[model samples]
Each structure stands twice: as structure tokens, then as C-alpha cells.
Target: MVTSKVKQIHDFGQSIWLDFIDRKIIFSGELKKLIEEDGLRGVTSNPAIFEKAISSSSDYDEDIAQLSKSDKTNEEIFFSIAVEDIKLACDLLAPVYNEEGVVGADGYVSLEVSPFLALDTQATIKQARELWRQVGKENVMIKIPGTESGLIAFETAISEGINVNVTLLFSLDRYKAVAEAYISGLEKRAADGLPVDHISSVASFFLSRIDILVDPFLDQKGLGDLRGQVAIASAKTAYQIYKRMFSTDRWKKLAEKGAVPQRLLWASTSSKDPAFKDTRYIEALIGPDTVNTIPMETLQAFRDHGDPASRLEEDIDGAAGILERIKVAGIDMDAVATQLEEEGIDKFSKPFQQLLDAIERQK
Candidate 1:
């Protein structure tokens, strides 16, 4: 039986996705059991995740040894391993992906592109296309950042029918740009008479990281009470944007032609503050047509004691007031988001290199 907490999330029309993944879970049938018993609907992986799985595990040694024998560079070997694991993951989730349901519902895995090319539109597009082809799974979503360049790369990638997961988005403005790219891509596909039925994408509005970045500023400014609250306020505001964007006449036209609205996926949901509830991000953001990707720590916490609720819509006025109050308090949210996004790119890119270096030493 699906655990009531997780099942209640599904029953409320939101999907729960596991934020952690490795070959062990896939091969040991743990991923399958999560799907069966916990209502796990999708999987998301990044360079940091791959780094941890590759560096810390004896599980990947034999495969890495075999892969290292090839003439490919360590980076190439890393992707070869990642693609295979993603293929396995996609197959594991095929039942959910194939179910006839909503236009944009997903049972999928996300594979991120090299973050080093985040600012280079053409390069990002080329690599994303290559990753998409290499993974060769219809259920695979090529992950890209929501940089100025990444937005264009996204539309281009989607125009080519490659699903995209737009990561590292922080501001409402950036989120709107991502939604625009998604709709423009689908519109181009429809204009060319191409099928738009299966193209899936998500604007990943990260949660905990925002609070991590903003909370210090709040404390420094003597607004300590607002410490753990900025991220949720930002997220709820973004969810409102998601609703408005998908309800526009333009989105309606795409929907009529079978295009699915790109859902707002809440990423980085684990609370960084010990004072905050472990499931603070997940429980607060629950809503229809949204996804909350929870790391194992947060997921287990939520499963143990989460009280699910329709709270995304509950504090609309209060959320608006919080953001406006934040602005009046002299913390520049746009600046914080900018710093976090730049750091986020490095945060992902560095691990990938470290993972490769670890593999090189083992080889």
C-alpha cells in the first residue's frame, strides 16, 4: 500500500518525485518499490548527485572500470554511465509515463547538460541535443539552467522535440522567461505541423537555496523572524505565475493542439534551518499541476509526520505582503538570485569534474 502521506499528496493532484538516485536503487529494485509503495512518479539527477553516487560507491566500480577501458575521456565515460543509468530509470518508470492521462503528466528521468556552457547558448544547445540523443529515451528530460542563454537553448531544444527541465530558476522574471520559451517552442512545433503531444518540460523553482541565501540577509537586517519564510513566499508567488501563464489565451491555443503546460517543479525542498519543519517546503507547496522533488531526508520526514494541505493558495495575500516587505527591508532579491544562480552553475559543474577526477584515480 502507498503510504498515506505520499498517497495523500497524489490524491491532492500533486506528484512526488525522488531527488536522489544511483545505480543501486535502480538495480536493487528500490526505485521500483518507491514507485509501487510511495507513489514516486519521477526521478531527477544532476552533476552533484552523479558525483556523490560515483565517488562514494563501490557500486559503480566494475562499470567504471569497463567504461574506462574505452578511449573516451573521463567526462565521456561519466556520461556513458549516466546515460545507461537513466535508461534503466526511464524503463523503470515507463508504466507511469505511458498512462493515458493529463497532457503533460510525467514518468521520467532528468539528465543535466554540462553547466560550464550555461552562458553559451549554441554550445548549451549542442550538448543538450547530444545528451538527449545519447540517453535515447523518450522519457528523458535534458536539464538546462534558466540563464539568458539557457532560455534560448531551451526553446531550440524543445523545437527539436527534446524535453527540457529548466533548472536554477530563482526570480519570477526568470520563471516567466522560461514559460515564454516553452510556449514559443511548442508554438513553433505546431506551426511546422509537428506533433506537440509528448514534449514535456518543467520550470524548476528551487526552494531551500533561496532561504539559505536570503535568511542571512534577513538576520543581518534584524528581521530574524523572516528567516525561513522567504523561500516559501517566493515559491508560492511563482506558483501563481505558473497558473496565470498556463491560463492565457496563448497557452489555450497550444493546449488545443495538444501541448502540455510546463509544470512548476519545486526543487531544493529540504529546509536548511533546523528550526523549520523538515517537510516545510514540501507540505507548504502542495497544489495541483505542480511537483515537489524531495531529497531522501525530507521525503522520509514528510512520510513520517507530514500533514498534507492545500496551502499554496491559502496565503496568497500574506505571501504578497512578505515579498513586498522583503523589498522594503532593503534586501535585493534579484541580486541574491543572481548570485545563487551563478554559484549554482559552479556548484553543479565542479562536482562533475571532481567525479571524473575520482574515476581517473581509480582507473
Candidate 2:
């Protein structure tokens, strides 16, 4: 039998995780097929994904109606439905998590905290803990945005042994800050003699959105050749940063205490420009100790015709020059990242409210 193309990505040391989750896929054995046949090792969900799934499908209607009749609020009802899905998914992927294989390392399922609380550190912390308790699964990763406030919440969550997926990150500077927070969390745990082995986290560095913002600036600046390039360049630079930080004595000390280096996960990876290859981000960003979470269409495109290789570290100098040229062309990367973070939060927050309202209408 010919091996599916997605499984070949594993040979290069990068994981291809599904950037979606829904009740039908979980119960219909679709998720199982992907896990066993297509080499899908993980799942990621957010308010946007859940909103589209819950609002568009009858799969969740009965649960919504039953929860609506109870005293639970719309938000509670939504969580009740979401947590059950996550619980079931976690159980199905338990072996992948325990196998602890180097490539298909963690069988994680990500559930985001409320996007409304993106800036409210304390509320993010409280809700994350509560959600973790509700799900009650060893393999579930509570996703928090990599906002300024979220850095604190991440360290706190990881210090408490809760696995976190720090989402919505965009800039190299901010990615550094996230790595710092992860290290700080592990150090704190080790300082307290806490068992740091089970704690896991991933810094989700967004890919395609960088070009969505920066490419236009380049085109307007008469740098047509530079169009559709910023995202991969920035991600390559982020990987270099990952290597530098995780190789340090600080990380080594934590590793001695059983802490896993928080891996770099590439998020928002689908190629937005129809003119570009569908799997550009996935192919360009492949490397060891990292993940690329992709939506279904992009995942299928890769399996159909993707060429996987270890290209992430191939052009260290060239990647640096690309960012430098962006700077020379007057592109403000910090501003772009900041704007994307705010928009990313709103993107999820709006749909989340819509999801709650949709669930309420089921009554």
C-alpha cells in the first residue's frame, strides 16, 4: 500500500495537526480515520471553528435544547457540549499521547478560553482553570491568546501543571516573550520541587496573516518580488529563536527536571492567496520539534500533492534578508503583529457570542 503524503511529513519531524473539531467528525469515525490512516496526531478548536460547527450543524441541537431547559447560561451550555467532545477525543487519542513518540509526540486537543477575556489576565486564568476541571482530561490543551496579559496567564497556568497552547502570536519579539514565559513557568515549578514532567505547552506562531498584511505594503512599494513572503520569513526566524532558547542551560536544567521544551506550533497556515500554492506554509515551515495545524481543505490539498521536506532551516541568511528588506520598505512589523492580535481576538469573540445565541435559540 502506498503511504499517504501527510504521513511523509512525519519523516521530516514536523506534525500535521487538524485545525478543526466537531461532533460529526468525532462520532462519525472521520477523526479516527485521519488519526489511523492519515497520520493526524492532534486537534485544535476555537470560538470561530466551534461557532461554525455548532451553528451550521444539527449535530449539537439536542444537547443545546436539553441544556437550554436547565438553569445553565448559554456559555455554560456551550461548554457542556464542548467539554464532552474534548473528553471523547482525548480518550481516542490517548495512545499517541502515551506513546510519547518523538514525531507524533502529543495527542493534544486544544480548547480556547473565551476570546472576550483575552486582555483580562485574571479572568483568563480563572476560566482556563475551570475549563480544565470541566474537561478533566490529561491530554487537553487550554488555548489562550498570546496577548500581553496572556503571557502572565500562561506562566501561571503552566506553573500549575495545566497544558496551554498560546495562540494568536505573530512577531519575533513577542514570540521571544512567550518562550520566556514558558521557561519561567517551568523554573517556578522546579523551584517548588513540583513534578514538571507532565506540564506541556506550545507557542502558536501565526503564519499566513503576516503576508496578508505585509504583502500589500510591499506591492504598493513596488517590491512585487517581496509579495507573499513575510509570513514564511518570520516563521523561519521564529524557529531559529526556538533553537537558541531551548538549547540554553536554563532549558537544560528544566529538562533535567522532566520539562519538555515548549514546541513552536505554526498556526493560521493556509495559503490565503489563491495565486500561491495551497501548502506553501506547510511545505516551507517543515522541520523537527514543531507543528503545523491546518484546516481540512489545506490538509487535503497537502495529502493530494504536497512535497514535504525539512526546509525551515534551509535559508537562515535569506530569511533574515527578507525581513530586513521589509524594514527598509517601511513595513512596521510590530504594528502589524499588534493589529493582528487585536483582530484575531475580535474574530473569535464575535463568533463565540453568535455561537452562544445560536445555542440559546434551540430552547
For every model in order, what is the number of clashing pairs? 0, 0
Backbone clash pairs in model 1 (N, Cα, C under 3 Å; residues 3+ apart or in different chains), count: 0
Each candidate: what lDDT? 0.89, 0.90
Lowest lDDT 10-residue stretch of candidate 1:
99-108
Clash pairs for candidate 2: none
Tell me the tens digit of each residue's lDDT in model 1 across 1-363.
Answer: 445687689888788989888988988999998898888999999999999998988988998899878898888888888899999999999898988765248797999988778999999999998999998888899999999999999999999999999999989889999999999999999999999988999999998889988988898888888888888898889888888999999899988988888999999998887888888898888999888888888878888999888788877988998899889999999999999899999999899889989999989
Q: Which candidate is the best by lDDT?
A: 2
What is the C-alpha lDDT profile of model 2 across 1-363, one tens digit per residue? 888889889888888889999988989999999999888889999999999999889998888878888999889899899999999898888877888344226799999999989999999999999999999988999999999999999999999999999999999999999999999988898889899888888899998888888888898988889888888889999999999999998889988877788899999989989989999999998999898899999999999999988999988999999999888988899999999998899899999999988886787
Query: RMSD in angstroms, candidate 1?
Result: 1.3
TM-score (all chains, Cα) for each model? 0.97, 0.98
- lDDT of the structure predicted as candidate 2: 0.90
Error of 1 at 143 (Å): 0.4
| Candidate 2: segments with Cα more than 4 A from true spot | 100-104
